[model samples]
Target: MKRILTTFALCSAMIAGSASLPLHAADAVSNTSAEKVLPLNQRMAKKSPEWLSRGIMYQINPRAYTPEGTLKAAEAKLKDLADLGMTIVYLCPVFVADDDMNREFWSPRQKKSQMDSPLNPYRMKDFYHVDPEYGTDADLKSYVDTAHKLGLRVMLDMVYLHCGPTAVLIDKNPNFVKRNKDGKIITGPWKYPLLNFESPELREYLFQNMEQWVRDYGVDGFRMDVADGVPLDFWEAARVRLEKLNPEIGLLAEGTRKENQLKAFDLSYGWPFSGPVRKVFVGGASAKSIRDSKEGFRKARPIGGDRIIHFIDNHDISNDDYENRTEERYGEKGVNAALAMMFTLDGTPMLYCGQEICDKNRHSIFGSKFGCTINWANAGSEEAKRRQELLRSLIETRNSRPELTFGELIWLDNSAESDVVTYLRKLDGKQTLVLVNCRAKPVSVDVTLPDGVKRHFDLKDYEFVIE
Candidate 1:
């Protein structure tokens, strides 16, 4: 006779207290055991590091950060970022890139580079070494060391899903590469050869490389690229190993999977919220869309301790379409309002390298070939000075106010929902009210507080206030 397993039998076997109970009784006992396992949100909140909750992330595209485009040159500006209240410095991929530019399948962005042999940082040739164009391994070490001294954490952008055709792994471990049924290597979104995560040897190799960064460079964390493409189990296993090295190390996933927040990642991108924000401010959509999106995100991910990394602009958006830049499309006041929402909202805020100066130029990952370097000369201008002061104030406020970082968010309905957004954040008996005008015209709104106190606000074009 074949053996059979039933739900009641399994429950009875697993729970000692349910072993002697009836079938229905055992089912109830199993349900009780299930309740003991905390919800995903509470589990995430309990396990996430304190530093991650209060961090202000700043992205640095080394190739476009300075005229020299070297890590050593970029190191000189660390103090400036620290002064601006930035807690984390995220560096884009600096590893050696494949030099075979003659490949026909190069992406459109890659072909725009002016150099005869354009070195796209995303195409990794060697994970172990830093690209000489950006300086040596010693330079990277010094950069991390200096950041640590300034009380700033460092996160490297990890591209583990795919690699250049001529990557070192191809010659050393060919079986590590993913292939189709026809025996040809599989390509990913960037037209690069994908890695086979099913191979334990390959997984171990990548894990070792991750450890090398922590062991040798003392990196605080990693911002995973195309994280959704990789298996969730791999990230879960990687997090377990990484935690043994540094308990505080953070893992930021670029994708938006809710499960990523359960175990594999500390934070994920806030695309759901950002898209509606762009629609409202840039596409002339109703401001109410912003509120709807936020509520939708909350409903979709009911277990809410998951954190999102919010940004007005990042490398991919800025590079893909120069015209879509926040500053270029929305102008100075619009940029300020958008940033205010990002800083005062529920998620952790991030700033791209040149965003503070109202940089109108695109800072491409491919350096000046496809885009321009930050005009440091603009720092001395009156306009740049004003932007810097405003950003500094915002950052300081966010860092000092625990209420803004760990508060409960409540959206307040207002008369001007079409052109304005109003919300409240409460924590530990402290309440903060945030009002933002999303349109280019003045807006007046009547907002009634939970205490039944009514107040009126008149805001100028694209203005934001935190009370």
Candidate 2:
């Protein structure tokens, strides 16, 4: 879920600054530029599917999702996800990883070993086949089918920006790759070959590959990786071509581009909000910082700010984060509060795999090692069951209460003190109000409601209420 193009900026602003958020929280824009607006027809070609708009997205790293590490095993858990009330299941790239570490590569982990690791799902070796390590081609199809049967849409994550060193495309079609002035291959980090967008045939090849996933595997859409590296024109053209095959197919981008970027896709990641929320609940920032940052995002994209997917924990932040995972940083109780706000606040919320169980083991971003896989035992444990119930109830409210999902946001004036922040959401003649306490100690706050109920109340730290 974390397809970070500017990891340094995110690491500095989120992980390091988690202890104390800077005053200007929304200034952290990645690969930012003045956007040239597109024509009205292209800008509003499609609205995000209603199911997706109201749904809470869940990111699944199939490799480490369970002990079996196969799609069949993942298929078995479809009912569990359905019970959690998740509407979307986004699986990381099922494509083969470069098993041949014969070529040179360097990981951000600072390790100098020349060994093969299947941890990085962003690198692809073959687009046609599902990773044998994960499962056979049939296994993936079955997984997607099961998701659909359980009333969940599946988004297959695609790594289209670059390919692994031993990627089949490197030698199979040299014309499809980016090359330097001297004619040698242009290499990104880890010596992976960058794709040449200028090649029409290459673009066509990718478009068809995308179609195969939807047509053959029965996936609903794709969660594109490093979308910023690919030209905007290419994406718009690709969307036009692919939608013919399935108009309902949604396109989700990982980068944090502005209005022009949103024109080509249905959704984008709200990564900028990550650190500020942590700053409020776990770090020392005030509750007002959350409102300030969200307001900044709203100003930037007045048309479709809610399309950005928001989350407390995702694959990148949970697995290979520069700082500790959300569980460790926020602790168990703090996680509940952070997630509660994520579900009730702006945009479509997301939950990373294993979060329901409060999974604590951190896997290497490069690959999973001993003792790092998700603990299935927690799935039936009391703590995990409690979280499942909490998440289910939150999602139930989000769906049952239209104001919670599609309402206009209005911060309650002076309704909260330093430790608490309250806001009201209104839509379709209904209103929903939320109050969250980020403090660790119980405190009383004077607050007024729309129904003329005004009172002071005490709340435990990281507690919240929706009315």
Off by over 4 Å in 2: 1-46, 110-119, 189-191, 260-262, 321-324, 415-418, 446-455
Residue-wise C-alpha lDDT for candidate 1, range 182-301, written one tens digit per residue? 878988767888999988998998999999999889999999998999998999899889989998888888886656765677777777667787777788887877767656554433
Candidate 1 TM-score, C-alpha based: 0.89
lDDT scores of the candidates, listed in order: 0.74, 0.68
Model 1: pairs clashing at backbone N, Cα or C within 3 Å: none
Q: At residue 107, give the lDDT of candidate 1.
A: 59
